[model samples]
Target: MTEKAQNINLNKAKSNKKDEFYTQLSDIERELKHYKKHFRGKVVYCNCDDPRVSNFFHYFSYNFEKLGLKKLITTCYKSQDMDLFSTNNAERAIYLEYEGDKNGNMLPDASDIGIKQLNGDGDFRSEESIELLKQADIVVTNPPFSLFREYIAQLIDHDKKFIIVGHQNAIKYKEIFPLIRDNKLWLGFGFKGGAAHFINKHYEDYATAADRKEGMIRVSGVHWFTNIDLKKRHEDLILYKNYNPEEYQKYENFDAINVNKTKDIPIDYDGFMGVPITFMDKYNPEQFEIIGVGIANSGLEIGIQPYKPEHKYYRKEVQKRGAVNGDLYMMINGVVTVPYTRIIIKSKKL
Candidate 1:
């Protein structure tokens, strides 16, 4: 099939699938209502979404209007019907059908409100998207799972506020865990019971018996992530697992521990304090102290060896010889590195 023809088909398929997902919105309406209450009188951006298929639209569109939301910006991979959200007031609602190239390359137009759509895959990694993010007060959408890292990073980089949907495992992503550790973000109220309804790939409302249902399948757990306050509307469950002292003692020199997977934590240790990566947001410098981090890789060590002054003078001589050199020197330890997991020392108060 031609690229245009395929795009048309894909657009239809996505629209249908999103419509099916909307059927489940009623189950989550109460929580969504609370989420929307926080966005009253605010400009909301829904990137990588069609309003019809979006929970943000299905649940909060009316509330947004009632609360005097200044604007509602929604975009799709291709221009399609968005009449469902059309209101008489142009200031309150606007929809854009992003046009992509023959190869499916598209960017968010200058008129586009929030992050510029880059690569047209619905991920928020484009330069324009980052710029739009700077203006946003809150983002509400179900972003593509593949680009959750980049999406969250852009939000953090610009310090933009957002409410996004993703998988539960996203809490364990090396990049995401730190945000929680530093108290910059936290988990939403949902996903406490372990399973949520997501529209299946066959466009079924729920998982069918015939679906493969294996690792990284199309059908998976859908979670909500946001920095917005839900106003004490959540059930208190142990979001962070407790650290086992037995386990910490076994891993010496580790002052504190964050158990992304509580069940997998080691056994037998002293002074090993455990908390979930979500605790990053709750991290108190007076309570728990971070010591150091470790990375497990041989190739990285080998690649930087030449730049080490003690190992050889090749790196220094290249600069001295004017071999297109700059102030690039590889050091063994002075540099600060970000780690997936770090051992922190807990204060007596915590």
Candidate 2:
């Protein structure tokens, strides 16, 4: 699709309010396997989940004793935690608190679950939820994607460790990038194939070419963001490319060289290189220093490359090599456009 058409679709998606993406149990196990050790004796809050269908609750409750969790709390948006096909009869938001099985059964059964009403609608920002947040040691949930920024801010504000799902595109957000740049957050083991198939009661089926299940929507560009450290965050990305000015050209409006692909980062180059936002998944804090991000009118203290839909993307060819007058833009065959969101960086000693 043309850049202009893509932007129109993206704009519509940005304002869209369809945020009911139910994560499958398999996806939970994929990432949570690495975090089991952190949950011991800690209260886990799946504050944005529906206890009736939340795999998060399902997983933790079943593994509560194994993980040494003190308690498991789940809050649902409004009163929508009933059977998927049930008619609406409730008006108040609700929550469920599980303190593990009381009997010798060692299983988290429905009889042992305690369901309660919330004084508010259970928005994660509600005072009641904030009180619960204060009680939690770790927050884990697939929050509403549209509110990812606000949701993550709340967690960071409370200094809570979290494992949550959001779009990979969020890495460029002003509120999010600084956290990554400062090493306060990093991407978790992302969704397989960089796409997630989510279930929803509202959508019938998107019928996309990826994995399409009944009542499911396939969303690409999804990733998990967290504060917890992982082994991948410390591993170095092997570099093999050498700098060639003909292939690595400067941006039309920025001073940094444009790296079309992360693997193509040259070992000999030391200056700032603007790599794709996906670089976060493979980012090793020890190997590269995150300088900043570049976007159109970002005014980010680092650099800015304003997004222009009319411009076409070119591969390894430059129309012009821009100067440092602060207004230089990289052109390809005389066509100028904004590059994709990039995570600015420079390599460390090999």
Candidate 3:
């Protein structure tokens, strides 16, 4: 193989290694409880999960009767081996279907669940998995982080409802940003304390010793993304601060005022305001109107102007701070300052 091909394969191997992080059962139960009303008599599929190790499968199976679920379907990717991380050596994969407790044991047993083999590797994008997705009312899983865009696209293409785990950074993706703008997707009640501790045995835990748990990796900025309507999405964020020109700096390229922090968003500012991406966590469609993103290409598409010729000298300084031509920047204290990516929004009430 050529050097380029070898590098591609090596990168894929690294991504697959990162994909092995498992969702804790407690985390699954905590998020699923809020959506209980939507699951009655519905078929739920955990497409990117191994029934052997996936807490997604365990959560639904244990609560099958309680949720009034019609069926629970889980597909294992790339391996039939009973291990935490998939070996990905097997050509064929398997799926399991559990209706409920067959025996009087009130537990999901090997005999009770119907295990079946698949013709292809059980990728969420596989034709076999798509067929199963068509049968599901809800898709819940902690899919491979590297494939989040493709994974979400498939669910959207099939018009399937989903509650899946993903990094918060996915919100800024070109494909994903449009969905949030259109209100087709929103953040679910996220992990406790804005982070999650996922079960993993492969990667080294970088979390502090105080935060580390046995055989688990603490991932900050992870959240549940869902198309399902959530109560949290509708609640208005109570803004207390009043707008002041000194505190809220106007972007030179965009018409929006830049508010450095989400909590510092002004109650009286009715005009366009650019707030940090975390603002989405408390977003309410009824209370706020999402204008457009103030990132590179997204900013340009929304008519955010490029830097003036007179300010050309400061381009090098701004670029060093990671601000490109289309990103919103401002002249702060005679210095060109570029804030992090901001989501432009306007208060419907103000």
What are the clash counts of all predictions, listed in order? 18, 9, 0
User: Candidate 2, overall lDDT?
Assistant: 0.77
The worst-scoring run of ten residues by lDDT in candidate 2 lies at 319-328
Q: Is candidate 1 or candidate 2 better by TM-score?
A: 2
CA deviation > 4 Å runs, candidate 2 = 1-19, 81-90, 204-210, 303-329
Which residues of candidate 3, in runs, are more than 4 Å off? 1-19, 80-87, 310-312, 317-321
Candidate 1 to truth, TM: 0.52
Write the number of the candidate with greater TM-score, choosing between 2 and 3.
3
Q: How accurate is candidate 3 locally (lDDT)?
A: 0.83
Runs with alpha carbons beyond 4 Å of true place in candidate 1: 1-23, 79-135, 201-222, 230-249, 252-270, 275-350
lDDT of 3 at 341: 77
Predicted model with the maximum TM-score: 3
lDDT of 2 at 102: 88
The window of 10 residues in a row where model 1 has the poorest summed lDDT is 82-91
lDDT digits (tens) for residues 105-166 of candidate 1:
23223443233333443224545445545556777766655567877887887777887766
Clashing residue pairs in candidate 3 (N, C-alpha, C atoms within 3 angstroms): none
Residue 296 lDDT (model 2): 38
Q: Which ten residues in a row have the lowest lDDT in candidate 3?
A: 1-10
